[model samples]
Target: MAKTTKTGRPISLDSVKANQVIELLKSGHYMQTALEVAGMPRSTVYAWMNGTRAQNSRKIQDFVDTIKKANAEAEQALVQVVRTAALGYTVERVKQKFVNQQNEQGEWVPVMVEQEIIRETKRDWQAAMTILERRWPDRWGRRPPTINHEENEVTSEDLPEDFL
Candidate 1:
């Protein structure tokens, strides 16, 4: 038997509600949204994760670890998507078309034919720039040009006497 709150909600990490929340998180859902979708209170979940409710429980620790793993998986997936967008890709589209043809019986018949279309997507320059800037900030990132006031400044002594 698992522990439950007064309202009959399971407090254990292995509960169905917890698993639902975990799956939602793994699928890239936000924490609040996952909790809401799973019918779990955000406050309670936060309390468990932060160790405010069950500070010394092994189950709580396991739950926190699982949430972290799910979030990491989601982040990895997002990174892969961004990388793919930056590099661009080719996609094949399949379509079914109906063509009118004359059969051996001299009757016009509708025939279904499949067509494959290949599409090439151009690379996203902005996304590539973003990746470059993040991966090599010192080399690709934008920065203000450095200026030396003393070197560029012109004084009366350095100027021509007649002009001063």
Candidate 2:
């Protein structure tokens, strides 16, 4: 399998369409001719021919389940190779580029990392809320203030960024 530049994700090209191209190649068609016949992109066809495109976990799991269920040893072995390649992503070289500066009290704080994560989570939550609101406007829309509402009870602005 081929590897991606980021995360070194395994790339798989064992789709039904690729199989058809492979069949054409095995039947004496030139690889280039086969790929052209398949109408697939050059990069995609090259990846398929080289067996390098199966980097997705869901696809790996599907392959494993399929071969195991069918009890096909050869196919199972191929699936195992795909699974192994897909799982071969290395994080060892992922150096911690972040260096936390010490405060006056000499305590190193992860302020930036924490803030970025919080911001990203908040953005994701807001996007989810927007989707939910679009899906069910009446259910999520603002309601009229009740006469018996508690004075101490917080309104929407009191909620956290992500929660709101």
Candidate 3:
């Protein structure tokens, strides 16, 4: 029931497309692409998002919070998925079938052999741990220790300044 602009399009804030745009944005879509997906104009979307029109600052802040929450949840979920993949990896003895030459002829033969094969999940786990460490450096990151030698250190100041 909102008035249409001179271009015969309803104001973005008052139109149903606002929710569509917001939903796309919350799901990690870029602003321009999200609005494009919703078939809305960039100027209208920016106006509403920037609080240039009837929409106020608080609404824009809520949109920002939604995007942040989505990001955090995605990060946590990524770590969890990677952890599961990594933990499932194990080095174990596995029987593998291979084609090998077993005669004077060039014919190939199938041989069953047992060997130690490392599961690929180990790499996935390491990757997950790396990502987690990078994301939460304080909790899972490595910090080079700062060692001080003040007590047992010799001071250059005690040396003669004219030693040169």
Candidate 4:
């Protein structure tokens, strides 16, 4: 296919497919996959969204909305994962399998074996904090302390007297 020219919009792009891409994006799919569904390249999408093409292009708002929606959904999911893990989770499972047993006839026979497994999970505090910082910056972010210097400009005379 020919590259998108002055408009920076792929010739293959269509509203139905573009909406599908947005849905996929909102579902937390990668950009490459979303672009594929949209039948466009990343460059073309960005150009259309960021106004490299027409400022008032209908695609711009739709693209922006798609990105924002996707980001919000992803962030929400991340926050939920972290929160759920922090709250602590437990899993209990039962597994059944067949094991080979030596029969009285000196032939192997299948025997059913049962096993129970229990697991407990917790979120990584540091990693969860990182996600929280990214998702809810104002609430969970830890900002580096700012150091304010008293001196605005230092002249030669402001240097230590001992140096002179």
Candidate 5:
């Protein structure tokens, strides 16, 4: 027998579906999209996380913990990517090529070989500026210039000659 929610909807506590959702979440998919891709209802997952449903089994609790861990991992990965963008980094690109080679059986065979190419990404000035401004707003953020209202007050005497 399967567990049902208060609304009589079957709670899909399938580990495979949960793992699929976790993987999707780790890949930066939003909760709704992940649930949809995993063939699970958004309400079911949210209810498991919120413990709003009557099904308070150990499986549900474990599923909730797994979801939280997956979310944290995704967030950490995103933060690392942002930090890397703020500070330039290098990446390795791999390419595979097929070449004809003589095999031990005295026959020509196609062999696949991998070639790695290193690439350097330049730091993004905008990303760096944004990080600096947000992290140290008092020093790097833009602020409106201070004006002395009493000294800069305008009067009718200062009007242009074209004005009556």
Candidate 6:
């Protein structure tokens, strides 16, 4: 058998089989069809799908591995673009989607990013409050009472008896 470099190195027998399975799957081969064609056990295929099996008899594993690699590359590229370029006139904002999960207490909760932002905003508000306190010293330690100037205005009839 003539051996050649398939992916920068000699392709192993298992890898070749995995590639064959992937091709068959992409060509509309169903699980049952692949099982019969590959002559591998059904449990083995399932294990490969879940990444428990190290060997590549199941074609789905190969597809999943490829997808993971592609996702990582895409994330890296996006990070590079954001790091190298400065924001234009309009600020770029991204809305993150969080999946709710149950805790040990069985209560659903938001992801960590939401919690982190809340903490950051609270810290910022506290800092602003400290700055305000420095700028305006309160007379009574509590916030200065808000007074309405309109209520204190004196009408002509209310002038002192001496003036009238």
Q: Choose the strongest candidate by TM-score.
A: 1
Q: Which stretches of candidate 3 lie over 4 Å from their true place?
A: 1-11, 14-16, 22-28, 43-54, 57-76, 86-123, 136-164
Whole-model lDDT per candidate? 0.83, 0.54, 0.64, 0.72, 0.82, 0.54
With a 3 Å backbone cut-off (N, CA, C), the pairs that clash in candidate 3 are 86-125
Better of 2 and 4 by lDDT: 4
The runs of at least 3 residues in candidate 4 whose Cα sits more than 4 Å from the true structure, single-residue gaps closed, are 1-13, 90-164
In candidate 5, stretches whose alpha carbon ends up further than 4 angstroms from where it belongs are 1-10, 90-121, 132-164
Between candidates 1 and 5, the one scoring higher on TM-score is: 1
After TM-score superposition, the amount by which residue 16's alpha carbon in candidate 4 deviates from its true location, in angstroms, is 2.2
lDDT of 2 by residue, 1-164 (tens): 99757655355545775556556654556556766887756775455335586535566455435433433444445545554444443322222335588888999975444322111111234445554566588998656876755767778999999995
Q: Give the TM-score of candidate 4.
A: 0.47
TM-score of each: 0.62, 0.24, 0.37, 0.47, 0.58, 0.25
TM-score, prediction 6: 0.25
**Candidate 6 lDDT, 83-150, residue by residue in tens:** 33423123344556687889999999977554222211112344344444655656323465687878
Question: Per-residue error at 100 for model 4, in Å?
Answer: 23
Winner on TM-score between 5 and 6 is 5
lDDT of 1 by residue, 43-118 (tens): 9779877777744667777777999999999988977877888899777666768899999999999998866676
Identify the runs in model 2 with alpha carbons over 4 angstroms from their true place.
1-14, 48-54, 57-164
Find the 10 residues in a row with the least total lDDT in model 1: 5-14
Clashes of each: 0, 8, 1, 0, 0, 0
Q: How would you encode candidate 3's per-residue C-alpha lDDT over 1-164 as one tens digit per residue?
A: 99985544544232356567666665656778877887876876566546675644565556546545655665666667677676665655665666675766867787656555655434465776787688899999988977678865767887798974
- What residue pairs are clashing in model 5? none
lDDT for model 2 comes to 0.54
Candidate 6: regions farther than 4 A off: 1-13, 52-164
Candidate 3 versus the native: TM-score?
0.37
- Tens-digit per-residue lDDT, 1-164, candidate 5: 99964656555588899889989888888999999988988887787777788556788888788888888999888777778887998766767778999999999998988666767676777778877887899999989999999999978898997896
